[model samples]
Target: MTWNWDQPDWPKFSYKSEALVPLEQQFLLQSGEFVGACKHMGADDQETLKIELISEEAVKTSEIEGKLLNRDSVQSSLRHQLGLGAERPGIDPAERGISEMMVDLYRNFGDSLDDATMFTWHRMLLSGDREIGAIGGYRTHAEPMQVVSGPDYKRSVHFEAPPASRMNDEMTRFIAWFNDTSPGGKTPLPPLTRAGIAHLYFVCIHPFEDGNGRIGRALAEKSLAQNLNRPSLIALAYTIERKRKDYYAALERNNKELEITAWLTYFASTILEAQRNTIARVDFFVAKAKFYETFRDQLNGRQEKVIARMFKEGIDGFKGGLSADNYITIGKTSRATATRDLQDLVEKGALTRTGELRHTRYHLSLAIQSTA
Candidate 1:
């Protein structure tokens, strides 16, 4: 559909490529990258990726659960309120690939990333993945084609997908333009804001079938990389999954009316939130790093294990931090053994008690990441 901005239902950003400029695009990217880079460092890169990927998958699952209630809030909201017990088989298998592919981008294209690389990432993102269906394996082989899930599966049909025959040329154009045009020729575009627009436009193009959402998300990550000059661990997907309701609704709203201001705001807000979340995660990791650095020699295997688990799980304070009961469960010891371990930990000064009796909780006597 050739977009006619005058139409009532047309999106707010209903203009062609000629309108948006390079200066604005570059500026957005540069600003977004600065914050993103600061938020991007810390943690063993591998462990960080693993934790973040799990977090994203958890968010994805929560969003799917949210979608069952309503597609609007389900897609747009970024907070995951669901407690444990949420699961989705449709998504489980794909999580590993998402994680692996993203990390691979860091390994393979960290220095030289761009649009074609983004397309290649999307290809890896969807390829051989049953969740995304047919669009999974190949670039568009034909034009005038409708993107649909298997006929048997009545989900995800993008009638807007370009004709199969034209897909190659269309994608080529998009990739080329994506690489070269920030505001097309002389007009500048900010990198930060460009990420938001590029993301929307890519999904608007709806180049694939079942994997559009996933691919769109990956595209967002790649955009961040280009903006920041490195792959970031913020898990913007996690933030979206957390706020699944608002995410879907915002996209739907934009897709139907072509008004992207709301979606752009949503995307920007999520990017900011993802950055904040990563900062929190990094802080937690930094604390863990300090704990090990400062007291590695003082801790025993059990203490080391306990501290590792606490940081890994982001546990702050606990009453009787490691109670006999928790020791029984986590340490796999009997009440007697658990009690003995707790007493030992207390004696070692690694743990301290609150109340004299059952009310007692344990905390680190020395600061985990204390400036003092």
Candidate 2:
């Protein structure tokens, strides 16, 4: 079967966006609320949120590609890149590379898409990947670039990209199309529609020797940021990673044709969910700040340290709740001190305890107030 790129009118993507109007409206409204919430947050909290979102995207994007990244290392790298602080030394090259790419994307979201920018991102993506034949350039291999799965003897090809020979011309048109469809371009499209199409179009081309999925998602983020006139701060890759099987199926289904209404609808829903998750995260941070303010004078250094460690788990607290051992480990205190601190926290309404003795688990007691 011929791929979408093999069609006569290859790059002319079509979709019925009338049904997506409500989702687009909801996304815009939520985005405004998100921005408003961010503005009200203290400078420190805003910086923390920025780092958190970027770190999450870097980790999740890599996860979607079956690569696991250390979240803490990614955050440290991001801090270094954003000039918030010095990054931890000896970071894995993959983490550093993606963090650099994320920071660049965040800083230059409004810039026009070009070959140089794409190449720079490619170089950053495959910074230490030694297996690839081409690092910062388009694929030039003689064999067809195919997405496949299963054993080699009975491999199933999901999709096949254009030949290496067509890379230059195909990418030239793609860059022009991406730039021209921007908010300030000659033929601007709606935000979600543009972002969705940019992702599908780029991946169909599959211009890179590797890392195309990650880069395609970045393009989608860039498209949304340009349309919004600011950094989107949406956890797009995080959302996509959660339903990755569905994500691949959607892409595979639309690969044989140009019309992508189903893909657009799916992407729009994902964007909305991402916006909601972000809004929740903002609320979580705000609530955390309030919690600290209320208990600032009542808690000692060890209590504060342990609670902060729990907060690091984000909106969802510890998986099985923070055990006494967890408190001892994170707070670096003895059993007696840990017990006293735990009792004190419960008395001060900072923690809620459940079960009995060894079975007991401690949970933070903060309610995330709506930021919208």
lDDT of 1 by residue, 198-307 (tens): 67766666666545566666556666666556555555765776677787677656654564556666676677666656555544555555556767687666656765
The TM-scores of all predictions, comma-separated, are 0.62, 0.93
Best-performing candidate as measured by lDDT: 2
Report residue 257 deviation for candidate 2 (angstroms): 1.7
> What 10-residue stretch in candidate 2 is worst by lDDT?
363-372
Q: Whole-model lDDT, candidate 2?
A: 0.92
Pick the TM-score winner: 2
Stretches > 4 Å off in candidate 1: 1-96, 107-119, 126-173, 183-187, 314-324, 343-372
- Model-by-model lDDT, in order? 0.52, 0.92
Give candidate 2's TM-score: 0.93
lDDT of 1 at 287: 55
